[model samples]
Target: MNDLLDRLRGILLDTGYTIDGVRERLGAVAAAALSREETVPALRATAGDDPLGLLIRLWWLGAPVPARAAPVGLPVAELAAAGLVAVEDDLVTAAVHLQPWESGGYVVSDRKVRPGDPALRPDHVVGAGGASANLAQLASRRPVGRALDLGTGCGVQVLHLAGRAAEITATDVNPRALELARIGWALSGIEGIDAREGSLFEPVEGERFDLIVSNPPFVISPAGRFTYRESGFSADGFCRDLVRLAPRHLSSGGTCHLLANWLHVRGEDWRDRVGGWLTGTGCDGWVVQRDVQDPAQYVELWLRDAAEQGTPRYRGLYDEWLGWFEAEGVTGVGFGWITLHDSGSLDPVVRVEEYGGQVELPVGEYVDEVLGAVAVAHRMSDAALLASRPVLAAGVLEERIGPPGAEDPARIVLRQTRGLRRSVRVGTVEAALAGVCDGDYPLGPLLDAIAELTGEDPSDLRERAPQALRPLIAEGFFHISTG
Candidate 1:
């Protein structure tokens, strides 16, 4: 099988059939095979002697999958050919293509179950999924000496770490997953990863890393049928355990990055629930809940994961999931990213940032900047004070939120009657301008100008400037111009 896999991988590379192309073509072949016996030959030809594709075709022949069933034994070379992936180098590869699909709620990677198809095997090693890729790309790209990818699925995050860090280790509890991760590593040409087999930190205990990362098995399941995606705990115990244990394996100044889900238990704040995981760890942590889904939506999404459509199994699974949520008093589920830093601080900063609204900027870069802000906030004495020095000149407009239930509703508009028509939220005179500014003047001068224009007291304006600038500064609408 290995030899066959190797040969098929070579052919796929030479032929330039992308992973997506393979999936689409394979799915097309499989669909045809189920509907008509003549299509089996073409499907087999697509696999050629590739064990993974062969496995996928066998199942598709038996029953038409929902197109969401995971693909089995995907060839890396094929994925590269698909333009969905890029070969980073002789060492360290990445999946740069998952972002666009991820935004649309699809995991466009070699490692996904065929879209809308369910007969494919669950453990099939495909390209890195969207969530895994998202966490990896958003991981700090700064230089680090050592890094660990916890729950290294297909070694996607490990691949992202190869060049950024001097040494890398990718760990997983599933041996099959470890092998697949190795295969991905080999395909990516990344080396030096100690592919250890263990759940979370067990394999890397006593060995600390400058960076520890994971996109763990966080889907709370009644029965953990899928080892790679689903967690053992019915109440998201896997994530809690990972959070609690991650601090122990970090080096001083080390950072742990991950994407996870937590149940929003009734009568319990999500922030407090996650904060509990960081307790006793002494690590500064930032947990952002990107969105919350009701139990019904959660069940439907997971059911769609296996391509189970209108099946009694789905109903039973939904009941079980709801039962688990109900029994635990969970009203919703919070999904987001967690970042922990073991930088050795007397008072670790723990913040739960919420981002449920629509965002205009590219989210990955925004996530990176926020992380950088966290790092800066830790080091700086007064962020507001530092921001006042040499600000840029950016025009900001104040758009009114609709007037409260008035007969004639007000227009929500950005009225930028000055410099650049940049829509930024700036409160008051100086602070509003300063918040929307591109760092053109001194904080003192900006406040002075605002006081002069708005008839506010200068001292009072100066005092209020920082508060107004906080929101604008957080958003990149106000950038510090180094020129």
Candidate 2:
């Protein structure tokens, strides 16, 4: 079984087809099979309106050939138990399909999302969605004793975490979601996952984990849907509660990775707003505001989602979303990754880094790098304490600006040359550090020299030096001494 899984992973990776791509193609195969079935009307009557589930069943009937050589003698029950398919009320359903044996898992069809039969559950398992994949890849893949996946939609994150953690527990508000997760788990042949039906931590209460990952019901609702996507709770606060609850559920040295949204209030700093969420929790948190949207932008994105769900009146739905934002004093909304590490520090490191410009890397990879960077940053001390101190090249500058229509400058700007395109506001000490950092002496001596030169406190200079060096090291404007 391990050999088969390894071969499958190797083939998939070599073929350049991602797990999501293969799952999507499999869904497409199922959809195409159902569309061509002769007894579609009969199945529709039995299945209600879940086109996705209907397709899954149709694929299972041997009509839609998932692969050319269909692994003859493989039991359908085994596949279901493995989480590849679902059999409900005598209907066959497949969460994913494969067309041919490529180097890796490959699907040659356009995947589809089908709802389930009305009697079964409202929020049926989706094959795999972008949000789930993003959150899964963004999470830390290092070894852990136990991990918890909240709102484990279709069990994608659970399946991924199973490889890294000794044990994994997944939870969702809907029972059907657990069923779907089970199907995905079985089909993928992933192990060590336990699925439960409950909202958030209800199922895992008093059970602490080394890592917690969630996509949650982050889709801000106009009016809540009864199924998987909605929390029946309001925006911002809904995710806030989930995060706040995580600290208690986390073991010492544990980490919680969340994909969340927070409303940006007018005249309020987004960092301070998110920073407030991390206070008194005995956790070090890093929040990145990946993207920001105005009211119209926010409305349009979720409006498309409702329309996809066959909701009527697109304009009305848009209006409702706008009304929700207005009533909540939300001028703008920011979406990003939030990581909380349970380090047991009284004053833990809580930093907010914004990725404002275009990201050349994929979102999942970018988020993964962010987590890796966080882990690396945790191991290192203050920049001044780093043994591998950076030797910056000469083009960095401190530019001061003049007040509008005034002869004197308004403020000092710390600017870097080459790589990362980073800049900062230069305080008096930072400006002094920049001027003196010629890479000859250690930071302590430089601070002493500067204190004597400017009649300032040497302790203050020592404390402020690391702040200036951080951007330099991160931006590659300063290269560290490996020696």
Best by lDDT: 2
Predicted structure 2: lDDT: 0.62
**Candidate 2 residue lDDT tens string, 1-483:** 344445544443443335344345345544455445333533333243233323333443222423322233334465566555566655445545433221222221112433321221346444444566557656776789989988886666766676678988889887766765564454455666788888878999899999999987766665666355567787777778887889999998898998888888877888888888877667878787878899888777664443333445557767777887888777888888888888765656666878665432234433333433443344456653433434554467778888678875678786655322457775665566667666666667766787898798878877766666665454434444433
Per-prediction TM-score to the true structure, in the order listed: 0.70, 0.65
lDDT of the candidates, in the order given: 0.61, 0.62
Q: Give the clash count for model 2.
A: 25
After TM-score superposition, the amount by which residue 402's alpha carbon in candidate 2 deviates from its true location, in angstroms, is 18
Where model 2 places Cα greater than 4 Å from the true spot, the runs are 1-121, 308-311, 358-441, 446-467, 470-483
Give the per-residue Cα lDDT of candidate 1 at 4: 43
Cα lDDT of model 1 by residue, 353-426, tens digit: 67654443334334545544454444433434544453433344446555687663244333333321235433
| Model 1 clash tally, residue pairs | 34
CA lDDT of 469 in candidate 2? Answer: 63
lDDT, residue 282, model 2: 72
